[model samples]
Target: MRPPCDPSKFVAEIVKNVPPSGIRRFFDLVSGLEDVISLGVGEPDFITPWHIREMCIHSLEKGQTSYTSNYGLPELRDELSRTYYRRYGLDYDPASEILVTTGVSEAIDIALRAVVNPGDEVIVVQPAYVAYVPAVVLAGGKPVIVSTHRDDEFRLTAEVLKPAITSKTRAIVLNFPNNPTGAIMTREDLEDIADLVAEHDLLVISDEVYECLTYEGKHIPFSSLEGMKERTVMLNGFSKAYAMTGMRLGFAMAAPEIIRSMMMIHQYSMLCAPITAQIGALEALRNGNDEMERMVREYDRRRHFIVRGFNRIGLDCFTPKGAFYAFPYVGATGLSSSEFSERLLNEKRVVAIPGDVFGEAGEGFLRCAYAASMDDLKKAIDRMDEFVGGL
Candidate 1:
């Protein structure tokens, strides 16, 4: 009999060390259960605007099924360039500085792979998006985590970031309007960070995927900061703003050389983003502004309702200034984040992600996405109150 192949020997050590996404584990668990109210996923509850969907269908009918340029359709890039300039007062050469990818997720992966050298350190702020550390690891780099606190509204300041830098530090990952914790950095905050990055001569991967979703103040583009454009790779997409998550369209804006390097990786791995999706993205940029505004307004309404509801229920939720999630302190329930989440799911039939899944600092909190319907949100809150009362 042939000996069983040792899978451990064949699998790359780096790949093996990386854990599966914690967000998806709970998502999959709750997906199988009936009538469960889920606030676990950070996705928009709205569908893609009908015009955008129709544009995709129209493109398909017109035989626009062929692959786009490896860097993506030039027309789409032009629109992105114009939009960025108009929205954030930043200019990018559509031809050289922009490259479209499957999603902001892919933009992140390729950007890290393009810039990181083996053993180089990438400073990642926590609680960060789950993909950041693993993407750095896959690129043969070390992720130096700097935990941000709710006391400071989870903002990564120059003081917190400076201590994490070392001789080997090559880059910093900044995600404002951040996931899990919807914290945003003010202009002054970014100015401090920008000065630090300039002094250290470090590259920056700025994930502004939630830029358009900011509530309390305007979203600032990191690359737009003085002396930072050349050093920053800005990632954004249509997923959250246009409610086109499943369409998987995202873009990166950086210096020509950095974009060139990312394109080399993207071309080999992805070839091109789906042409139909590109067409839809193009339409979204052109005509989806009013719809985007409408969605944001609705989300704002829900945001206020949910934050108030959580605090009233004794969960002690800090007001989330951006993104669709509320990271409420669940420590009062005398349960660890996982225990609280699991028990809540099992007994209340309402799902919220355990915050520690985002980082160790997230242990006493739970991430509750407010993207569900008002009716569902109300129902979940009521059930959660009952659960907390029992505890």
Candidate 2:
């Protein structure tokens, strides 16, 4: 005589222990509403450019729907090898070191599962992507959070990171041009931590999905630093850069042994990234740069406009140098992050995610994505002005 829907009876302990994504919950509130200008999710507003979609269509017309090799399409991996080398001057073998994942999401999951032993400690920097900490917990590792401060421009420094290390610490997850904060770590910023990673012999799981969207500085791959490539599992994806989120393609690069380990989990769990998507991704790498840059330029414009608008409306907003988000301090409204977001939605119909959803360190801020149309951005800003002015 158990209750009808008891979590303890039906769910795994870890599954029950971890709460559902706070971002997802906010999105759910907006789902039934009409004319909502949602800045909640961190997804691009651009469509996959014509050529990438055309390639997917061409694949389907050619009956190319079969499962790809468990590792991924070889040709796609080859193209990725060329792309990374051309951009970062880093070399990863197409055969043994590169893995095309279902998305960067799956890449993270498999990589964590492959490396984490039960109770091993993994460092997750906050305010972090919603996925990182949960992914670590699900992989059987204890997540050790290191909060990055707004005063540091949200950069994680070696001096701040040194005290967090211990013998149980197995790895650290690094995301630059980060979501929520839209913060980027420059080469000097990253080099400081690279030295620490080297000193402690810690592994790095670097998610550089937003690398192409960097505005103020050149993007530097963590693996490019001396003595770090062998210890880093680097992940990048088409979803962010190419605006191909629906296609669900991403790739991971690491040493041969690590690649093999991740591939085993991937084979059993996902088998392969879709064959049609692989063909599309290959086409994207070959010809999508200009279109991608165009989108980035537009985002750059919207970024400035929204940030200025937020500041003018009396919110102290940090100007983000990369990605398409503006993190505005909403404490001026005298509300908790959730309270501010709920009140805004109920009163203004504009959707900015409550920053505490990202992490506890994010409680006083609101993540406003600039990925919306300029018209929407303008109206959202105007509405925000009214909302704050009334308060």
Candidate 3:
């Protein structure tokens, strides 16, 4: 008889060493509970717009179920080409310059893999989305973490970013409006870093999935900066804006060569995004703006409400001008982020992600997502106040 196989040994040591996502453990806790107000998952509360869903259904009804080109549906890419030019004044060739992936997450992963050789250092700003660092490591790149501060509204200014770049630096990841903190980098702010990126001849993986939800001045594409377009891979998706998280459709726009490389990895790995999801995404790009804007207005309203609620209860929360999260400093409570989050879940039935999961800098903070019903937001705040009072 053949010896019992040890499939577990096939897992690389580095893969085994990578910690599980900090955001998911709380989600796991929330899943088993009843009457819990969760402020953890960074997803919109709105359902996918009716038209978008209708398009997906219509496509399936028409028997359009086969896999699309690895580069994604040409129609979607053509729409994307027109849309990017119209929205950002940046033109992308639909045939050679765009690649649709399973989601923005996959785009990020593939972009890193395509450009990052083993041991190359990729600058990752923190507190960042949970996936960024691990993605860098798995891509065989060393993650050089750059921490942004609350005083700067968590914007990664050139001053903080300069020190992180080294001779081995290969690329950098940019996300704004940022996750957890809801940070927005102004045009001048991006220009500051753009200069450094151009100076160093580095690459940028700009994750603009949250771009449409920006409530501040217009969102500027980092690729629009002079001399930066060729070095930038812009990742965006329908998940956040159209509330199509389940669809998992996202695209990357980049120089022809960069896009081709990413497409190679995507073709072999994911093959193509789901046909139905791409259909829904096509509808979103075509006509989902009205519903998207309506949802943004609601999120903006909740944004102000939740920030005010946290501030009123003595948690110092910076007003986030974009995205749907409020990062509140819970250090005054003398509880570590994990301690505070766990106790809040156990005693108060309120769920919040601990800042420590975002990175070490995220310690002593709680990321409370406002993408929930106002009723739930209010109740969660009350419970938080009670929890802190008892502490």
Candidate 4:
């Protein structure tokens, strides 16, 4: 008989330090509760538009069910290339510089794995998406977090970036129209980052999945900077903008050499994104802009409703300029982020993610995703107001 396996031997050392994603726990807990209003998940509540859905069905009916090229279908790549150029004024060779991945999440993973070596240092701005640190660790790198203050709109400045850099630094992971915080980087901010990155020769793994969601200003691609194109790996997707999150279609754009290496990883890891998703993404790029704009406008309206509601209820929320989240300070409640969320959930049936779930910098706050119906938003506000008033 084979010897009994040791449980300790089965788990990797890296897995021990990485905590479970805090975002997922709230999602799982809320999903089981009946009549619970959830603003926990940072996903567009809208359905994939009819035309985009039709494209996927049409492709499936046409027997386009087989695996695509590991780099992705050429048609999708061509359209995505055109879309990026048209929208951001950044030129990328579809054939040599783009690799379609399962989602922007996967693109981030691929980029991290492709560039980072053991003990390499990657600078991450927090409060950020939960995936960045773990992705770095899985790539055999150390994540050096730079805390961005809520008071400053969560902008990651060169001042913060300076101390995080050392000789071991390999890259900086930038996720703007940031998760939880909803902050965006301006052109001036990108220019400053370009100067530092150029001096340090640092690679920028830019996650711009929420590019289309900015409310106050235009989305500026970090890759659009003069000296940044060759150094930036852009991660974009059909999820938030097209409401195609379930389709799991996203792509990465980088220099030819970087794309070649990422393609090799993609070939071994995922092979390719679903052929159906590729088709849907292609149609989304071709025709989904108008739909995206409509949704963005809707989100903007909902954003104001949520923020103004919170203010009226005595919970002062910082109005977000990008993404569909509002980070509100919950200090008056005399509860920690987790405590406040739990109390609100049990007492009011209103579910929102605790900001600390994003990182320590996210403490003293709560993240409310404004991706629900207006009625739902109003109901949630009422519930929260009642709960807070009793405090």
Give me the runs in candidate 2 sitting further than 4 Å from their true place: 1-8
User: For residue 145, what is the lDDT in candidate 2?
Assistant: 87
Q: Candidate 4's residue-wise lDDT over 83-183, tens digit each?
A: 87788778889899999999898999989999999999999889998999999988889999899887678888888888789999999999989998889
TM, every model: 0.98, 0.97, 0.97, 0.97
* Residues 49-145 of candidate 2: C-alpha lDDT, one tens digit per residue: 9999998998899899899898899999899899889998999999999999999999999889989999999999988888999999999999998
In lDDT terms, how accurate is model 4?
A: 0.90
Please identify model 1 stretches exceeding 4 Å from their true place: 1-3, 24-28
Model 3, 211-264: lDDT tens per residue?
998987888889999889998999999889999998898999999999999989
Q: lDDT for each of the candidates?
A: 0.93, 0.90, 0.91, 0.90
In candidate 2, position 308 carries an lDDT of: 90
| Clashing residue pairs, backbone N/CA/C < 3 A, model 4 | none
Model 4, position 288: C-alpha lDDT score: 84
Model 3, total clashes:
1
Among all windows of 10 consecutive residues in model 4, the one with the lowest summed lDDT is 23-32
Model 1 lDDT per residue over 56-107, tens place: 9999899999988999999999999999999888999999999999999999
